[model samples]
Target: MMKFKFFLLQALLSSSLACAGVMGDKPETETPNRLFFAGLGGSYNSVKLDQYFNPLIGTTNIYNGGTLVAFGTANGPAVPFHTTQTTFAPEAQLGYLQSFSNQDWLWGIKLAYNYLSITMTDSDLVSPQLGTLTAVTGAGTGFTGRATISSIQTRIEHEFDLMGIIQHSFKNIHAYLGLGPTTFGTRTNIYNVTGFADIDGTHVDVSGTPVNFASTKWVWGGVVELGMTYFFNPTWFLDINYRYALSPHNKTNYTSAFAGTLANGYTKSGTLFGTTNQYITVQGLTFTINKVFDFV
Candidate 1:
């Protein structure tokens, strides 16, 4: 009976030792769900501006050297002009992350905002007909007049994206690819002036009134990303990603109103119509610190 009791004690001790060794050799597994994240980054954005105006024609009578000269209806270009500008913009995003049962595949949706601005100026002689008339004083001498134009535009983009993501993990480092659909709410304001007469400081007011216009539009787009994450622990990580996004053409209509009397005492009051169709593409490298929590 004594020998049997001693053998039972030895077996129990050997089994406990084996269990400890097995537990020590195995690695700890992470929970399948990561709940929320907030990120900040910089985006390189390109805004394309396509502006076209309808033909503006009018007449004014100016007295030069005590004689009245009549300037008849004149025409401007009907074709639109296009310009592009790039800006380094700051962007912020907030969203929740959802994981699949497989854990290797996940999905997320986020709201992001970016602010951008662009300004361009174009100066040309008022229609050649008008320029030639302005050049001739009542004396028919070579008194030249010229027209100048300047435009300032500001725009903001609010975006939302639904993403499909795949991730591969090696210890604490994880790499991921994300593909998604992006939607944008864009708002823009434009201020412009054409026909400033600065020919030798004579300050002729032949130009149209200063124009203030605003428009808002919605656009559909797509975005893709490749990223890597380094985990500081189970709940904190640093992530860096390269992202690209593009949208189709979207149209905006601008209506401008100007009121002022011309140098010839003619009330230059009227409305001019302009239209723009714009396409935008953006690419950037982003760095973020992500905090993940378990779903309650």
Candidate 2:
């Protein structure tokens, strides 16, 4: 789904540019051209995370009758997790802008980087029988299996992209479209879990259970951008733009190595994977003052 959305947007951008190029309108290319440029800016970004957990050691579904809880509904146990966060971060871009000697079309190669932090939490009530793998207990055992669990996750990432952009100038302003491949270095920290559960007639407090240690992954994605730039003068200009990025789903398996103890002293671990195409789309508002060197 994410990949499809990204490609769809790309195709739209391409079609628009192709049609514009066919109009046979020639732009004035007599203004000073920028040969190289660099910029620093601030970005207000929104990060949304979608997480899925599956216990590879046992049955994946553990709710009664194998039905998981529905979101915002009084359905069953094993509530779903969803979170969104807004962050303020800094970004930097360095690139070379090229122009034909007698044309108003501009092309450039740019390298950019963004750094951001995200923190979120999810909590729910789980049936104690969930601890019993493949066997349903607590019936006639005088013990009701019930517990409350909450998880807090913190993550930080450095994202980089190398892109190619094409722009068409009109007087003092120009509109541009860019597409490129991006790479992300992400680090995630899992804190101790908080909850309680009943196991085989015994009640145990599930607190500070080591669910996960710190982990990191390097992943790849793609980005598409649309924006307009206005020049106050040949050497200085203001740029405003919006971008959408899509990353492939990242999959990781949790073993005993990065596990912590559960409520009943059982090892806490699960196989985690990104569902729904595991991607991030950032809506950013950027303000930049740039200085361009004229080779002429």
Candidate 3:
């Protein structure tokens, strides 16, 4: 009986040791692998006029009934016609990200869309007449024009944490910096009068010669962004970011009839045409909510 009791004690000690060894060899549970996110935000935009000019002349002689009027040097007033514009824009982004480790370092790529609208107003414009009047008339001869710009941007971004988190309750909050190139396309529309008014304030309808312009071209530029994100959950977070264009430079040329009626009873008309090679910088603050899809 003493030998049997000794054997039983030996068996229990071996079993316990085997169990502890198995437990030790088993791997520790890993952090969940979450990786993709989508977000929406709004931004404020400021657009300014870079350059504009218009010039007109009569290509044909004027014949008022049996009188052959000499098409002398008839010059109209030079009117400055443009206004600066500003407004708010709405934007959306979809991104795919992969985390290096639980230390809070992440690298990602994003595709985004932005919508903006700008307005140009010309007030109290003067009509070009047959006589030498070089002053803008106070009469309501002004018109408003608008331009809409949209863009599709592809970006690569990196996220960095100040204090690298290893073991902490609040370790997901961090700051990040981003930069990338953008290709944009823009559309513009202008509306104005064609033809001169008689001395009795009667408009000589010259509908045959109206001005119009349109364009959709690829514009290239770069952008830089800085922001902070708060990770409320393992796979969910919110961020507030500010972005600015590194090079807001572009050139656009357009031609349209502004004023005056043609001398051949077709009403006089002028073409305002020029290219704007100027810098357009914008500041935007946006709030974004994101969800991660882990695949690790």
lDDT of each: 0.58, 0.57, 0.48
- Report backbone clashes per prediction: 0, 1, 14
Ranking by lDDT: 1, 2, 3
lDDT of 3 by residue, 22-47 (tens): 99896543323445666677666554
| TM-scores for the candidates | 0.57, 0.63, 0.51
Clashes of 3: 14
- Summarize candidate 1's per-residue lDDT along 1-296 as a digit string, tens digits: 99999999999999999999999897754533666777676667665555444343333444444454534223343345566777776777676666667666556655555555444332331322233334234432222333223443435356555666677666567787878887666766555544433334575555465555677677788888888877777677777777777776666665554445666464444344455566666666767776766576
TM-score of model 1 relative to the true fold? 0.57
Residue-pair clash count for candidate 1 = 0
| Shift of residue 5 alpha carbon in model 2, Å | 64
**Ranking of all predicted structures according to TM-score, beginning with the best and ending with the worst:** 2, 1, 3
What tens digits encode model 2's per-residue C-alpha lDDT throughout 83-115?
A: 678888788887777776745788988777778
Which is the leading candidate under lDDT? 1
Candidate 3 CA-lDDT value: 0.48
Cα lDDT for residue 145, model 2? 37
Candidate 2 Cα errors over 4 Å, as ranges: 1-34, 56-78, 123-150, 193-211, 257-278
